[model samples]
Target: MYINGAWEPAESGATFAVTNPATGEKLADVPDGGRAETVRAIDAAHAAFRGWAGLTAYQRSEFLYRAWTLMLERKEHLAQTMTREQGKPIRAARNEVQYGADFLLWYAEEAKRVYGETIPAPRGDQRFIVLRQPVGVVGAVTPWNYPVSMLTRKIAPALAAGCTIVLKPAEATPMCAIEMFKVLHDAGIPKGVVNLVTANDPAPIGEEFLSNRKIRKLTFTGSTEVGKMFARGAADQMKRVSLELGGHAPFLVFDDADPVHAAKGAAMVKMLNTGQACISPNRMFVQRSVVEPFLDELVSRVTRMRAGNGMEDGVAVGPLVDDGAIEKVDRQVKDAVAKGAKLLCGGHRLMDNGLDRGTFYAPTVLADVRPDMLIYREETFGPVAPVIAFDKEEEALEMANDTHYGLASYVYTQNLARGMRIFEGLDFGIVGINDINPTAAAAPFGGSKQSGLGREGGHEGIGEYLETKLGGFSV
Candidate 1:
């Protein structure tokens, strides 16, 4: 981990193995950072906050631009490392690197545009001005699914807002975070402005972050359960928090939409990161009038998807992150199948053609999934698509909004009026009509309800690390 501008090991000299999920091989050992290391990182960030916050936005942007350039320069190597560690397909890994770089580039330019407001006071001799200031040291926790993009999504905006950060990357995939720190270091970022602590047991570190007063803000991306815990912990200190947590996205295929094209889009969304992404479509609802044709097209598309090691060429789907993920996916499939859902193609693990050694699940398609089934309500964070049929628009809307999660939802329809109606009716924060990919650096990415709190991108992202102060001046 990098701390106080130097590469260092854990104070206790403890290290843990980082494994390649695709091969079940140990890649390297990273520091097993704990409470003590977290404190060190926090203190360092707090000490460096003044200097970093004092720098002009233009100056900060220059450093961010340098880091962005370095990321692009090392794109291929970074992507390869991500594929080896995070288990996404090589092409997807490359796209993640590019996506991560885009955040840095976008924030680099956005830093100079943080605007304040001035208002006339009620009194004749007074003026009111609202100023945005950095929110002190930030404690960031990122997940492993989209390793590079998740880290950049948190750090880029925090840095652009003139806040220092002590980040804890997921233990399963720390190599990308380490590599990103190298880019920041080489970009001439001031010492202690950014710090990293990698730990398998993150509870102790999280405790410190929640209780520490110097760490004014907490930003996290992970499960909703964990996000709730963080929210409760931060409540005592009244710490500002921004959470981008779990999602059970719904993909709706209307009767008017082309079943073949909609099926292809749904398959693409569900297969991303082997369905590990929080925003990946989970519960797919199709109108009964076209459910059969849609299922046929969907099964065909899923069957054509090649599952193998990420390093292999032409492999669209890769292994799940680990054994635990595989088990969870298997359990859900079995439960769904036993409860009357028809398994169209796959519902088992793939152990053939060099995939026996790794954690791989075949892309599965399930039809006639009922509301009572576990797969219908829970997040199947694997390549298993459980679909249900709805006859009316009201029924489809009711089924889509049935979950506790409100992260994202998709509606595929040829009719503009129907699309607009569903788009407005869906309870999710992000709605896609005919578009499967809804993520971008320029858009506000977040959800309502248990999906998350606050946003992570666009102008709202920078605001997550900023505090507003109103000043009344006598003129």
Candidate 2:
């Protein structure tokens, strides 16, 4: 763990092992963060916010630019670390590095672009001004999947908004954040502006941090349940919160949708991070006319994708990050099958015979999924996708919005008007029309309902870490 601009172990002198989910091998040990250490990080961030948030936007942007350059210099190594810890394909891991670095650069430039306003007052000797100011220190919690990008998503925007951050990265993938801190330190970011801790028991650690008044804003990307807990804790101190949580996104394939091409693209995005992605398509609703053809092509495409070590070339799917994830996927498949869903292709674990020795699962395809099945309603944060068919667009949309989640949804249609209609009607914060992937660093990415709150990315992301102040002066 790195806190207060210094790299240090947990104050308790305890460590947690970092396992390579690709091979089920222990990679390295990271510090086990707890309440005491969490408070240290909080205190450091609290002390630093006064100076850090007060810096000119230009200065903040310049420092972030240097950090961005530093990130570029270490992209490959960081990507490898992410792959080793996260179990995503090396290519995908590298792409995350590039995209994460791009966010850093984007937010770096955006840092200097935030402007306050001068407003006219109706009364004589009264001048009004509006100011966007940092929301003091922030407590950020990120997930394991796409570790680098998730960390960057929080760090880039918060830093750009002139807030000092004390972040807790998932224990499953800690090295990526450690590497990020190294980049910041190498880039000469002032001490205490960024803090990190890796802990298996993050809730207590986070609880300790949220109890502090100086940590005024909270941002998290993880399970909806966890996000809710964090929100409640932050609320105790009246801390503002921005959460990007769970999703059971529907990938609707209309009759007008091209099965062959749509399958290819949808599969790519759906199976991302082994389908552990919060925004990954889980409940797929294909039109009755296209369901059979889509499944046929989709099954073939998934079969062709080589499942192996993330570091290897030509690998399409990799491990599930840990034994727990693999076991969870296996249990879900069994449960779904017992409940009546038919397995079309894969539904079992892929032993690490040649693809390394971690936790790997086959890319599973399920059909005849009913509304009663748990997998139909729960998040299949694995490579198991249930292909559900619908006849009417209304029914498709209804099934799409059935879950408590509303993070991301996909609608594919050849008719421009129909596609746009479905896109606008989606009950999601993010809608992908004729596209399986929609998130970009340039736009706001969030969800409605249980999916979470606020936004991350673009202008909205920066504002999440800031407070608006209206001031008046008598002229």
Candidate 3:
């Protein structure tokens, strides 16, 4: 890890091994970063901010644009790393790298537009301009899923806004990000401007940056419970926090919607990251009049998908992150079955081609899933989706909003009225109407309720890196 222009081992001299969730095979070793390393990172960022912030917008933007181009040139290599570490299909991992670079490209252009506006004063002799100044050093904590995109969502915008960063990526998927940090250095981001650390135990590492007064802002992406705990910890020191927390997103298919299209679209999301994504559609609420048809279509589409290794092309479902994820989802499935849900397809472990030794779980489908079931209430984070039916729009809306999570919601309907109504009523940070693809580098992404606080992406992303300053001047 690089801290203050030097790569060093952890003060504790402890290291953790990075393993492929697909096979539980060792990929590489990284530092077991803790408070000492985190403090060093913060100190480096604190020292670097002035020179980085003082650079002209055009100059800074030029460097960022260079970074964007570099990312595109090596997209495939980065995607392979993502697949190996996080267990997402290579096709999806490719998209993650592309989208992650898109953030850099967007913010490269946005850098020049980080503007300050002059205010009208009652006295002609007095003048004022509200400046959006950088909020000093920042501490970022990102999850294993979408490893590259999530990291870039915070890093790109913060760089555009002129804040130095200390990134603590999840140990499970650290190689891609560590490589990207090196890419930044090659792209002309000065030493000490961005530092990265990875470890199995991030509590202590994050605490260092979180507790430090020099680190003025924080950004995180992960589970709601952990995000809440960290945010509370940051609050103790009055640090600014931006979190992209967990979700159990609702997929609502109206009776008026085309069953085939809805099924195809919903299945696409369910298989995304093996359904490990936070904004991924976990709960399916179909109109009762069309429930049977939707379920039939869903089963058909999913049954057609080829499940295998991520590196294997034309495969939709990949292995879970590890045996733990497989066991957790398996247990959730068993609980749903015990709770009276019917197993539509796929309800057991793999038993072939060395797959049994790996973390592979077959894609599953559950019918008649109740709201009270753990699969319905908790995040599965694997390839399994349950179908629930509702007779009325009100009932569907109530069911959609039932969970504490309000990250992202999906709606498939031909009726614009219904889509707009659902958009307004479904309490979430973002809404995907008739589309499974809810992410874009240009749009703000995050969540509501316990999902998260603040937002990431577009100009709103840059906002998190800034603190408003009102200068008092008289002429």
Candidate 4:
């Protein structure tokens, strides 16, 4: 753990092992941080907030820019470490490192653009000014799926907006967080400005974040159920919160869409983190006329997907984070098949090819998945694709919007009018017309309804870490 600009262990001398999900091997032991450690980190951030917030935006930008450069320079090491810890393919991990670095770079520039505004008052010789100021100390809880990207997404904007932060990364992937924080420290981040605490049991740490008066903002990226708990805990203080929660994203493939192209795109996105991503296409709705062709292309593409250790050559998919994830995926697939859905390809867990000890699941595709099936209602956070057919545009739209989650949705269509209509009608915060990955450092990333609250990137990202002040003056 890094707290108060120094690396330290837990006060209780306890530690937890971070395991390699692909092989179930122990990677490294991290500090088992709890309430005491969390309190120390929070205090450090709170104490450092004045000095950090006092620095000019340009000054902050310099540190961020340096960190960005360092991240790129150490890209290879970061990628390897991420692959070891998070189990994504080396290529995917490398891309994640680059994507994470972009946040630092983007925020470095954006820091200089956090401009204040002046307004004229009705009274003679009166002036009004609106200023955006840092919201003080922040508490960030990030998930494990995209550890590097999620950490950067929260901290970059917070730092750019002049707030000090105490971060608690997911227990399953703490090495990446520790490594990134080292880069930040080396890049001249002020002592105590940024702190990190690793803990397997997050409840104690989370409680401190909620009760600590000094922490003005709490940001989290995880399940909606956990997000609600944080919201309730923060209610007393009315603490500012930003949540990027769960999603059961819908992928709509219209008859006009090239079935092969659409299938290829959906497969690519769905296979990212083995479809564990919150925005991964969960329910795929295809126009009935094009269902068979789409399934053919999708199954063929998925069938070729190679799942094994991330370090292996030519591996496209990797193991689930743990045995529990594999079990959940297994249960969903079995239930779907029992409920009359046809298993097109790769339905069972993969144990051969040196994968017996690891948490691996075969890339699965199910056809004729109905509304009542468990896979249809719940998120299949694994390498599974469930295809549902619809006859009319209305039916497709209705099926897409039936879920409580409104995080991300994809529509594949050649017609501009229909695309625009679907775009307007969809309830999700993010809509991908033909694009699988719509998230970017320069755009706001968030969801509507149960998916989440507030945004993570772009100008809006920085806004979450800032407070507005209005001043009136007579001259």
Candidate 2 Cα outliers beyond 4 Å, as residue runs: none
Q: What lDDT, from 0 to 1, does candidate 3 have? A: 0.87
Candidate 2: residue pairs that collide: 23-357, 23-358, 24-357, 24-358, 125-475
**Segments of candidate 1 deviating more than 4 angstroms:** none
Mind giving the per-residue lDDT tens digits that candidate 2 earns over 233-348?
88787889998999998999989878887888778887887898998998888888888889998899887777888898888888886777877788888988999888988888
Report the C-alpha lDDT of model 1 over 1-475, residue by residue, as the tens digit: 8889999998889999998877888899999989988898999999999999999999999999999999999999999999999889999999999999999999999999999999978999999999999999999999999999999999899999999999999988999899989999999999999999999898998999998899999999999999999999999999999999889999999899999899989999999899999999999999998998899998999999999889989999988988899999999999988999999988998998878888999999999899888888888899999999989999999989999999999999999999999999999999999999888999999999999999988988899989999999998
Number of colliding residue pairs in each model: 0, 5, 0, 0
Pairs with backbone N, CA or C atoms under 3 Å apart (clashes), candidate 4 = none
Predictions in order: lDDT: 0.92, 0.86, 0.87, 0.93
lDDT of 3 by residue, 330-445 (tens): 99999999999999988887768767656777888898999779999998888898999888999999999998898999999999888899999999988999888877888888
Model 2 worst lDDT window (10 residues): 351-360
The CA root-mean-square deviation of candidate 2, after full C-alpha superposition on the true structure, stands at: 1.4
The reply for model 3, stretches above 4 Å from the true place, is: 11-13
TM-score of 3: 0.97
- Which candidate gets the maximum lDDT versus the true structure? 4
* Model 3: pairs clashing at backbone N, Cα or C within 3 Å: none
Judging by lDDT, tell me the better candidate of 1 and 2.
Answer: 1
lDDT of 4 by residue, 1-475 (tens): 9999999999999999999988988989999989999998989998999999999999999999999999999999999999999999999999999999999999999999998999979999999999999999999999999989999999999999999999999999999999999999999899889999999899999999999999899999998999999999889999999999989999999999999999999899999889989999999999999998899999999999998889989899988989899899999999999989999998898989678878989999999999889899897889999999999999999999999899999999999999999999999999999999898999999999999899999999999999999999999
lDDT of 2 at 431: 92
Alpha-carbon shift of residue 245 in model 4 (angstroms): 0.3
